[model samples]
Target chain A: MATLELRRLRKRYAGGAEVLHDIELNIDHGEMIVVVGPSGCGKSTLLRMVAGLETISSGEIVINGECVNAQEPAERDIAMVFQNYALYPHMSVFDNLAYSLKNRRTPKDEISRRVNETAQLLDIAALLDRKPRQLSGGQRQRVAMGRAVIRQPQVFLFDEPLSNLDASLRVQMRQDIRALQKRLDITSLYVTHDQTEAMTMADRLVVMNAGRIEQIGTPMTLFRKPATRFVAGFIGSPAMNFLSGNAGDLPGWLPRVPEETTEPLTGDISIGIRPEHIALTTPNAGQIDGHIELVEPLGSESLVHVRPTGHESRLVVRHVGTEQPDAGQRTGLNLQGPFHLFDHHGQRLATRPRLADTTCSMEP
Target chain B: MRYHRPGLDVAAHTLLIIGALAFMLPVILAVLASTQSPGTLFSGTLPLSFGTSGLDHYMTLLTEPVRGVGVPAWRLMLNSLLMALGIAVGKLTIAMLAAYALVFFRFPFRRCCFWLIFMTLMLPIEVRIVPTYGVVAELGLLDSYPGLVLPLLASATATFLFRQFFLTLPPELMEAARIDGAGPWRFFIDILLPLSRTNIAALFVIMFIYGWNQYLWPLVTITSADHATLVTSLKRLTIATDGTPPWHLATAMTVLALLPPVVVIILMQRWFIKGLVDTEK
Candidate 1:
């Protein structure tokens, strides 16, 4: 177990074009930090740098209080699970898990003991003698996990390990991975493009966009109070709705806008609210009126798409059960308390602090 | 599924049958001549008759010697096998290592080196024959096995095929091995090489056939009769005196020289086609 600290970590190609810029993060021992982003956001690049598969263009990576930027992957004492489950296709499961120990020249008995224990823990003991091609996707994923477990490295790096499995298997394996990580108490960094996986798995979530960290917090903290407009839009399923409305038009539910705004709201000031936070009421009982455009019933919950009058923005509301207003039906939308407001530059703006004792306050 | 045009299929089959027979006619003639007596050869009276059906001519050719050569036929067979094995193994191993380096590693001028090597494939060996002969003689390797084997060791065709094959492999496999504490050499030998057995087998068969049928290079290099390979020795046996040739014995010796490459092709016919098809993909 070790604390991994990356101070001003940077990466660039040989011609000096930067891919990752000025990354600073500290991962405490036994913490699972899930890095989530879009495809070209450099999450995988950052993981590869930590695993020593890629060269760091600058900055120091310290593992367990020792700088490991100059060390080889093997010398850095870390293990990784790849998205394809990169098991040696020709080797049996036993040999696949035993390879690292064999490379280190561990005694035969010790290697067998460790491999058997890992297989039992992963519930893949029956598959020990089978080649990787013979196993299904989920079984192959377990074999990949077993290969990393037997080594018991100081940190485990996962690069979308569950992305290759089917939907049901992905959920099962995700839970299994979290449970295993907790039981072993290993420091881990997991990279994925799926926000749900990051939300459900990480002790801390790092939301990235365009090679920069947009926000870093607990999963609920990110959901409740995103630091930037990009993080707010990138962390949710239907994505937070952004309405180009004047701050002064929000009526009395919102606090009064500062007279001399430190960061002036020019052009289009954006207001963001989660889909589930918007409520439907009688036509005259709410602040804004819109007509329902589409209704998607997801059994337990429904999504209502609304087009507000005199505004080009489309708002989505999460309604419960199968009960939903018909398309073209006029309805009212009430903004939940303390919505996120952003300036034209997409940076979050300051709002008045909520009353501490108000139980219905939106600040989490 | 059946073709919609029956007439076109029938025409296609007819053309294919004629082409197939055209290809098989020479081999059929060679086999028929190998069984005929030396006296009946070149009579052109009855080419495929069963009159002389025994292996008597094959026995005579195997035991007898050409008048000027003074060497039995078995010695020529041994020399050919040795040369073919040496050249095949040498070329395949060197091509594999070079292809592995070009595919996996990063170094200065790597692309330049690959292009230089690949450019050799466009230049025919016949164009460089005189310069190659001079270099072989200056190195004092004329009339030697090293002289025959070393010049053919670097095969751009084989290197290009293997490099293209290696390029399609997913990089994640190599990355997994690195994270598992395997070094570059270990990762290649343990992971990449095992997955490439089909390719190696395919290259082996192709290189073997090429070395077995080689005529021009060996003809220019070897001067002594003892150092001559099978094809050159067979040529010496066929040029007889009195402007008349012993067609039966000459055909038998030709069959002997063709046997190994034929057997290799039959055994690995599937892999040979696979190698060619994989290159296009």
Candidate 2:
């Protein structure tokens, strides 16, 4: 219901060590922004700062066009669903859902109506009287969601809320939360270390590393066009392959090398290619011939690990369908034109437009 | 998994019966002595049979004043009840508030304050009875209920137990409450106090019994018979210095004194176990 803006947001501990640095993000109204990062990357810290749980070292947090930097969490008109649910252990489900309403001094009958409505919405109408300990993990998650949603706050802040559930339950709750957020049309800020969850849940993902945002874009844009070497590695499962070599001494076997760039490709360059973008061909027929070292079959697709000639490291080629090249078979790797090129500084270099135009069916 | 050894079962039952009888012997003797007349009590080698004067003795103890002390048994029972209830309620309140402040707030020297409170465990009322009595007397609390209860009010053991229990609560609960628009006082009254119900129940049973059994402090401070507690008055009933002691009335008073604590333990025993087990973290 409200747009959340973090301008120059930074977090520093009393010991003078910075955990979050110059985080600038602007979330649109009714949009779900997932801040994805590795552990200790300060994604949760950034979310906590937005929630008013942590002090803002130097920044302005604006919600609904009002500056909330000095406001308390309650005064900021926000509700947070913690990673562990954080439901009051002694309270029943009904009471947990009705807590914020009662705190705001709502009428008795109105509070009961809203609580019943919320419980019905969550399909937990039968669990009104049971304490938190008696409920299963998924039921607890529903109650936690009910607790946050019943208030109808300006923004919902989720601090890795689905991380505690089992795998199957995590998937189900992830979809349920996405549907619920859409139905309510509430702006939400979710933090998680799981890239798959972020890729599916976020309208736009804020990929953070070492307290700074590496990129802020849609899932498809981030996956297809990573701006840095770190984003290229962090965004995809099975990760992208990186090969380093001198730029001026480009081997003849290298496929579709960037013909030109504003910055001179002089000292060294790295080639980044997605595992799915490399097709295995007959050895000595395609560019960069190598022998397949191993094949990891994962039902529909199998990842074939290849060792290129004169290279110590192995390159993984993600091949679609169950049929895969056998281990120890010699195969030539064909580069699908859209592979990335990074300079010596690990920054992505501008490539020709035709290379980015190859149709990608696997882009989620 | 089911062990159905008849011989071992019989042997185990026999041992359990012996242990139970050994523990209940003193209480059984007290009940028996209370039932008998003084002459019947002194006549035999600890008579196992009940005397016919049981009803008469109990009625006299309940309705009439004791011969030398001139105070009804009910009055001493009421005094002990007040002292026990007072100490239990007072200790729980102080301990809970102290523990709440220690665990939830980040004030200056909070740990130092906790350690100072913890240090009092070494200086129990028995260890510092003289100085405690001096303070109570100087404050004009002698021969008053306050004198008996106030000196035993500061319980370091209960405070420590509460602090440990409070520390087991997740910090996220407090943050959630804050985001839910609950201030500190609301959080304490609504969330914390309700969550601490089992802990308070367990501590109440303990502190009540501890205060009821207090002998040395009441004996030192309470000079007037009007303010005598059950345990202190029982001492006066036996050590007469002039004539044969009224063993029947003293035994009757002892039986009365044992009822409240037993009833309390039986009532709160379930919650006491649950509290200890639930807050183990």
DockQ for each of the predicted structures, in order? 0.50, 0.56
- Write candidate 2's Cα lDDT for A118-138 as tens digits: 999999999999888889999
Model 1 regions lying over 4 Å from their true place = A245-269, A356-364, B1-20, B49-53, B64-68, B269-281
Model 2, residue A187: what's the lDDT? 98
Off by over 4 Å in 2: A246-252, A256-262, A355-364, B1-15, B270-281
Evaluate model 2: give its lDDT. Answer: 0.89
- Clashing residue pairs for model 2: A1-A187
Considering only N, C-alpha and C atoms within 3 Å, which residue pairs clash in candidate 1?
Answer: none
Error of 1 at A326 (Å): 0.9
Residue-by-residue lDDT tens digits, candidate 1, A122-157: 999999998887889999999999988899999999
| Tens-digit lDDT track of model 1 for B143-226 | 888998778778999899889988987788788888787888898889877777778877888888788777888899988767
| Candidate whose TM-score is highest | 2
Which residue window of length 10 is worst by lDDT in model 2 chain B? B272-281
